[model samples]
Target: MLYPATKVTLIAEHFLVERVCALIEACGGHGYTLTPVGGKGLHHLHATSDRATLVEGFDHQQVEVITTDRAKAERIAERALKELFTNHSGVVYLESIEVCRRERF
Candidate 1:
């Protein structure tokens, strides 16, 4: 059997990773994932030719958390947006998913 859960995804600036992960933990999230990513958007671009030259603060980054508690998921997103996104560019959203080994969430 599987249980329904909310998958919270946050795509934010590189520098705010510490804040985002801390918020997830403080909000009762058991586990989360962080990946260092870069791409071309209206935001800063990581040049393909020279990987090391990618802009520091303006590049792409992602943070995600999965939990059965909707309120906790929402709180993590809310805190990140309110504290981090007003002065920077980022987006946070949630998706519904069925997770196995439900207690792990």
Candidate 2:
């Protein structure tokens, strides 16, 4: 069986992942996943390139949360945009998705 849900994607600096997770959990989110990523943004921060190794990866992280409620996901995104994006370098968006085990969410 499939259930509708919202998938929130947040790409932020590595240091801000914790705070992002906290915000999600505080707003009735069940869980999330974090994957370390590296790239150059508008700031041109090439933390990891051919010249650098895994140890040099510290510029970016991708955090994803799957929530059964769309409003909850948007709330988190809005909170992040208002509180974090103004000062911190990050982007947040939401995608519609379907989950197999609805109860797990």
TM-score per model over all chains: 0.78, 0.83
Instruction: Estimate the Cα RMSD of every predicted model relative to the unseen true structure.
Output: 4.2, 3.0
Model 2 C-alpha lDDT per residue in residues 13-102, reported as the tens digit of each score: 877788888888888889989887765651234333554554466567898999898888899899988877777778778899999999
Report the error of model 2 at residue 43, Å: 4.9
> Model 1, range 53-95, lDDT digits (tens) per residue?
5545346668889999988888988888788777776778999
Please list the C-alpha lDDT of all candidates, in the order they appear.
0.78, 0.80
The ten-residue window of minimal lDDT in model 1 covers 42-51
